[model samples]
Target: MELTPPEFTDYDTRLGAYAVIVRDDHVLLALWDEPEVPILMWSLPGGGVELDETPAEGAVREVREETGYDVELTGLLGVETFVMAPEKRFARVGDRPQKNVQVVYEATVTGGELTHEVGGSTSEARWIPLAEVPALERIGLIRKFIG
Candidate 1:
């Protein structure tokens, strides 16, 4: 589907990365605030796949960076495209449209201690009971991944 740019800018495209980590009946999630967005949100621990890195490599790196945990990517979950409006665009260093194409993956937590880092993209990272997840506020895609 065709989507309009979030705003007029030099960069018109954006890409995203995501991971779905499930263990037993629980799933790990990261909660954070997007400065440009009005609400706090919870999602999988992941970020953008860097230019020279493969998605799987990026997934592992991002999970470690955001959650301080190591992960083994098992397989792909799916992909979703989001169109950001001008007001929703959170500019990092340059002016660009705030749209993103997210790649989601299924992964297993291999190792790491649960610890919270200050001034990070994620405020917290913890395991939530799989059943309890539905009741908690989270990205809709997370529920779909669990199903």
Candidate 2:
């Protein structure tokens, strides 16, 4: 799930931070290619919040790792959550349902250049035109960034 956010947590619950970087009518995205995870989709640059990192720090770090951008989080858009049943989750660790809590932030690129992450879950990164979003195959979280 990391290319998509953290190294996945073994706990029954997971918390992730994501960033929405829209610049000059283009939005930065990462192609999530984690093999073990079932879903493969174009997702916002973000990942799981580490134990030591705040949500804002986690979002900034994930953005850099997945999209090659140094983003300064401006404000929070909102938090999204989902509960995956035991059957849907790969394996149960502690609870009957796996709870996913995601914090998405609005950000501005301050530094760094576009680069495809190597040896990570995210295979590629790109800035896609906002007008073309509806036609592309992407994750649901993207809807918050694009029109």
Candidate 3:
């Protein structure tokens, strides 16, 4: 099969807000299914910040969508920045670097059930043991929160 680049514009950029939700020895994570890979990559449960929402609000919303858990922000963890070039695995267009500004927060689950996001970026939600996280295929953001 031949691989071609996806479409993008020079103005494309993204602002994301993610959360670290931990209880006991487990952390909440989402499974991201890559079309080009056989194994699913793991990431923290969160996504892009909406135009009308604050990063904190977006964190709460994303966590709920990805993990089926209503969470309350406990603290601001840190910000991680990524610049994706066109030749990167995720980028389809190389006109400009896609600067991803990621804001992470520490949160606690207040309500909701364990579920997966439907028609979303992630396919499954799981609470994985902290000791096993290092062996998992994950996005760079995972290191920012755990490390």
Candidate 4:
């Protein structure tokens, strides 16, 4: 979530969808490597929901785009809402506190070869051992999946 001083009257809110794809003793994670953003971390393969798509559809599409794996969304895991001030780490177009709503879902890999996401926020998709997740440097959102 990104927040900044409210510069406009209209509320600034964004919707995002993510997937928790786990298999055997490993969990799927994407290496987020946004240009000009110094913060790099391993996170679930998902992104902002498109205007014409449902959250579930968005989750599936995002996972495929970021992880190069087709997925079937099984169930909604949870929804999280957060507001934060946007700074250099979370800059946006408007200087307003952004309300971010995240929808998390449980998904399973259906098909597709493992490949890096081209021209996207995430560069690599990997199935990391579950036991090693705790020690990895990642965004706080990771707790939602591992826990």
Tens digits of lDDT, candidate 4, 53-124: 999999999999998899999988899988766553255766667788999999999999899999989999
lDDT of 1 by residue, 8-52 (tens): 555456666789987778888888676665677778888788889
Worst 10 residues of 2 by lDDT: 1-10
What ordering of candidates by lDDT runs from best to worst? Answer: 3, 4, 2, 1
Please identify model 2 stretches exceeding 4 Å from their true place: 1-11, 37-39, 90-95
Residue pairs in candidate 2 whose N, alpha carbon or C atoms collide under 3 angstroms? 2-5, 5-47, 5-48, 6-48
| lDDT (tens digit, per residue) of candidate 2 on 10-71 | 44778999988889998888988887667677889998899999999999999998878898
Better model by TM-score: candidate 1 vs candidate 4:
4
Alpha-carbon local distance difference test for all models: 0.77, 0.85, 0.88, 0.86
Best by lDDT: 3
- Give the C-alpha miss distance for residue 4 in model 3, angstroms: 39
Candidate 1: misplaced stretches above 4 Å?
1-11, 92-96
Worst 10 residues of 1 by lDDT: 88-97
- CA displacement after TM-score superposition, residue 133 of candidate 2 (Å): 0.8
Instruction: Identify the superior model by lDDT, candidate 1 or candidate 2.
Output: 2
Reference-based TM-score, model 2: 0.84
Cα RMSDs, all models:
5.9, 7.6, 8.3, 5.9
Evaluate residue 92 in candidate 1 and report its C-alpha lDDT on the 0 to 100 scale.
58
